[model samples]
Target: MNPLDPAGIFISFEGGDGVGKSTQSRLLGEWLREVTGRVVVWTREPGGTDLGRVLRQEVLHGDDMDPRTEALLYAADRAHHVATVVRPALERGDVVITDRYLDSSVAYQAGGRSLAADEVERLSLWAVEDLLPHLTILLDLDPTVGAARLTDAPDRLERAGDEFHLRTRQAFLDRSAQDPARWLVLDASGTQEDIHDAIRAAVVTRLGDALGVADGASLGEREVG
Candidate 1:
């Protein structure tokens, strides 16, 4: 196992597309910055480093790629991200918050596209070198509700079909069910404020005193009213 710096904490947020991961991640990143003493680095899989960003565009939006090829591309991006961004940050004792991680591949490729889950898991482990986040927060929302949250035209995977997203959503929830220790399911049907509060609570509970954010402080507690 690679050494984790005493101050390092890795937390990942996950969900199907349009589940407000981006928004919630940003909110939590800011909260961590203000409340925690450790250096906080915010990034995402498939696009954290420069190389990963280019691959992200090609992988997520490229409609011509084969399913197996797509899975490999995602793994490739994660390799770069884990090495170039995630590992180094953890070594530096920084708190790293990623918008998504390996679970996304299991949910999107294997569960959504009906590919073999074991293959995806094997590839992901090879890519990430078994580096698991200290905590993974899964935002749970219905496929239709999630799809409705998208304002712009959907991308290739986003447009895969309602059934595809339904499977993807269930995949994330199932993942949480299987690993209740490291994963938590956050209901996403509430208002943004409510959802954010729930996320902060989950983080505080999971991270405990390590986050330095106090057990009872709402995310709103950091905001200027």
Candidate 2:
């Protein structure tokens, strides 16, 4: 049975570093609030809750560890995040827009680190009690281009090298292809406005009935930064 709350909509934005996921997630959350008049919970993985915050710092800055250890720490953070923040928000009938979800674990831990993809996926699903996003918008971009867009110092994962990022990107594409209905693969090279428009359209299409809006109804134009 589906674990997600029937009254809530869950959307996740996923992409490599500097691919504009944070910007897009914020814009989408704002648009959803305006259109649906429902509470929108905008959050991110590995730092969405109190426990997650500490785990995020350690995982991103601490000494290098075994790939399995890193994956387990991420799963632990995800378990706490979903149980405390995401699941409760969904139970309250809110729209939850997360910056990353289980797919990120599969991509980064499994693909980037060369671990078993199925194992990584299984660990994440178990951590979240089988919860899954209603929609996953993947901003696909060339790793080189994405790296160039990052203005900050490299984090542990960001400095994992081009080959790792390439594998991660391919993993995302492969997963999207395997589940096309729940995934919207968008090119990250597009203008911000254009990308936001496409994302908005996808969200509207999926949740229009729940939001009491007709298909293709315009949600009004607004600048998204």
Candidate 3:
């Protein structure tokens, strides 16, 4: 079964650092399990598979590297992750929710590091075999505010400075704008509850049939809101 088939729903969360993507991903996974009783495969990029764990550590903590090297490493991890984890789960008709996906590569590498966006996009699409999410929830936040929200020591990507993050944020928005039907852009500055509500609404709208929920039924009534 192809992961992109209608039998499964693929959702990815994207945003700048400190944009609460992790929280939202977790919340949605729990909601789907409780309300819809469907298997939810919660995962992340560069760390979703065993190989991805080592690549993630190196990419995040290793010494500085060339932009092309960094992009290739990320692409490698993505390829492994999709093949070993994401694709199999989706092929089983599960809901695959990833914290980050190919868009992160496009925004961080191409937009932030001044690489050719189209080139980076092509590389990633080739790596993933053009597997895109059914819905991408983009948490839009100002880079300044996002930076301030980071309480821990900055990682290599995080320490790349404000200009890089601003460009990355714009790239996410631009991609979302280009494919409005496939993206749900929300303000990350909003309350967490509010953001999760919006995300849930979007997911329910798109995956109601797969989730086994009637189109007009109240998902909130089935689970803790």
Query: For model 2, how does the per-residue alpha-carbon lDDT over 92-197 read when each residue is reduced to its tens digit?
Result: 9999999999999999999899699999999999999999999999999999999999998898999999999999999999999999988999999999999998
Write one digit per residue (lDDT tens) for candidate 3, span 141-184. 99999888889899899999888998999999999999998889
Highest lDDT, which number? Answer: 2
Which 10 consecutive residues of model 2 have the lowest summed lDDT?
A: 216-225
Q: Is candidate 1 or candidate 3 better by TM-score?
A: 3
Give the backbone clash total of model 1. Answer: 0
Cα distance off (Å), candidate 2, residue 9: 0.6
The regions of model 2 sitting more than 4 angstroms off are 220-225
Worst 10 residues of 1 by lDDT: 216-225
Question: TM-scores across all candidates?
Answer: 0.92, 0.96, 0.94
Pairs in clash, predicted candidate 1? none
Q: Compute the lDDT for candidate 2.
A: 0.90
Model 3 worst lDDT run, 10 consecutive residues: 216-225
Arranged by TM-score, best first: 2, 3, 1
Tens-digit lDDT string for candidate 1 (106-207): 999999986988889889988988888888989889988888889988888887898988888888888899989899888888888888888888888878
